[model samples]
Target: MAEKTALISLNMGGPDRPESVAPFLRNLFSDRELIRLPGGAWLQRPFARLMARLRAPKARRAYEAIGGASPLRIWTECQTRAIGRLLGEEWRTAVIMRYWEPRAKEVLTHLRREGVKRAMVLSLYPHFTAATSGSSINDFCRHAVRFCPELDYRLIHDWFDWPPFLDALAHLVREALARFDGEQRHRVTLLFSAHALPEKLILEGDPYLDQVRTTMRGVLERLPEYRSRSRLAFQSRSGPVRWIGPSVTEALDTLVDEGVREVLVVPVSFVSDHVETLHEIDQGYRDYALRRGMTRFERVAAFNDDPGFIRAMASLVASRVPASWRDSRQNENGAPCQGTP
Candidate 1:
């Protein structure tokens, strides 16, 4: 029998149905890594439930605006299969949602049962933060320690500036810019929007902001034509707490004030379509841009299963796997892995 390897991708999942919205929010808020309650650890669950109850209705409405459920799971499954096929028969890929179904514990148990000898945990988040990559890694590690300590496992923590990834983003940006009339392309303000993190996390030494900036710089360097016209802004802020800024709303306002009538929004941090990209960005931001007198507002689609993106992911995974494993599987029959590093 061949040695079975597991490639696990981590993401903050969304509810598959309307009824799951509240529970998903509860699970998210209940995570100490996500929200630090005022009272104590004991108060987390109750506060999370209260917050979820207060927020669920609004969240559900947002979800409803985009086909009544999130496309995250569907897209993630597609990515999983694509990567697995590239990795060949020796490796099995799976996606684990941080806040919903197919959680860490369940995935760990499943791999163990499948007799997987080695596992590589890959974060869907290109960038890292205590709230996201940190939390997911810690959660999986905890479960692995208790349930599958013997399994040989490793993590691909952050691949924000990977070459193939940047190439794919640059390609997408160029494609979106092409949508505008050639004469007006130079006037389009390319806004790179990343998910916002609370100021408190930065105060605690979280490197999310810095990493995001680094990613922005790297991407800009690759697309020198857009460097002067591009700007970075943060989005998806919730609660009253101060978050890294300028918020996407403020950025739009600034652009409107600057007499910029055309804008192209790029969700720099996200790889798959979810509530943030689907509704928050496409609908909410588009409306805000129009209301502010912008004549055009468009966003680049998330990479999803873009051929370049899958190749980048495969390259990242291959780079981390044992050399012996790579050498042994190099001749496996299947479509060749493209853009491999």
Candidate 2:
């Protein structure tokens, strides 16, 4: 058989299999990139271990709310197949959930075994955050160099600037706006909500907030007609420290105070519906809005399984991958934790 180029589809993984959830979360919480611990290594280690235990029941509960597990894995698989089809059959695609099955390291190993040298890694995150896509790529690079010494990786960092993604988001929001009762249209306040990161990260010079804000601005440019009707807020705050806010719940209350009777919650920062969107935004904040006398609260659905989103993702992959990656016919020797050489 002729050699095939491998495209590893990456995601944060789901809890579809109950037995794997804890260990999966351990990997998740262990990433210093995700959760910053106060006490350095010792505190980081014990704290992560403790958090995994304390959060399991609650995490399990949240999973059960959305069908006893997360849908990220299934959604990612669907995206992989869709993107592969879009890219043509010449490309070999595999799905890997960083904290779940078909791990980053395993996929790299498999590609090496399959005699695939060139690799295109599409991080499932549309916007880059050190905690999410950053960690995933960091993990992939570290593992790839160590395990698949002969494989070369080309990574797609952030696709937030892509026109198609902005178009799709604009389209989705417009569609939701159209669905609102015409009589209440003026009363509908569009709330753009993204997952919150620690403010400390911003102070420390991470560009995540600026990137999402820029994407939001781009999205707003497409919304001139509705520009005056919407506002931005942050969501999914964890830990004891402050997170980027004007939180969604607080924003909802403020809208009520300002006489807005309806809200359209848009999950702009995320591409998939995970616990943050499903439990926190949909269930938690929806209830909060209802209690505060907001007559209607609707979420602009996450872009899962959307054809336009897949096109945007594929375009991102096509544009960013280095041309040299196309020439490599065998895995190239590289060390783990080291970036693409």
Q: Please, what is the TM-score per model?
A: 0.93, 0.91
Predicted candidate 1 versus true structure: per-residue lDDT over 1-341, tens digit per residue: 15788888888899999999999999988888877768887898888889899999999999999989988988988997898788777778888888998887888888888888777778888888888777887888788887777777667888888888888888888888889998789899889999999899999888888888888888788778888888889998865578989999999999999899999998988999999998999999999999989999999879999988998899888877765555654433322111111
Give lDDT tens digits, candidate 2, residues 250-315: 888889999988899888777877878898888889889999998899988888888888888777
lDDT of 1: 0.84
Q: Which candidate is the best by lDDT?
A: 1
In order, candidate lDDTs are 0.84, 0.77
In candidate 1, which residue ranges exceed 4 Å CA deviation?
Answer: 324-341
**Model number with the top TM-score:** 1
Q: Residue 258, candidate 2: how far off, in angstroms?
A: 0.9
Off by over 4 Å in 2: 1-3, 324-341
- Model 2 steric clash pairs: 142-337, 145-336, 146-336, 149-332, 150-331, 150-332, 151-331, 151-332
Query: lDDT (0-100) at residue 35 of candidate 1?
Result: 72
Clashes of 1: 0
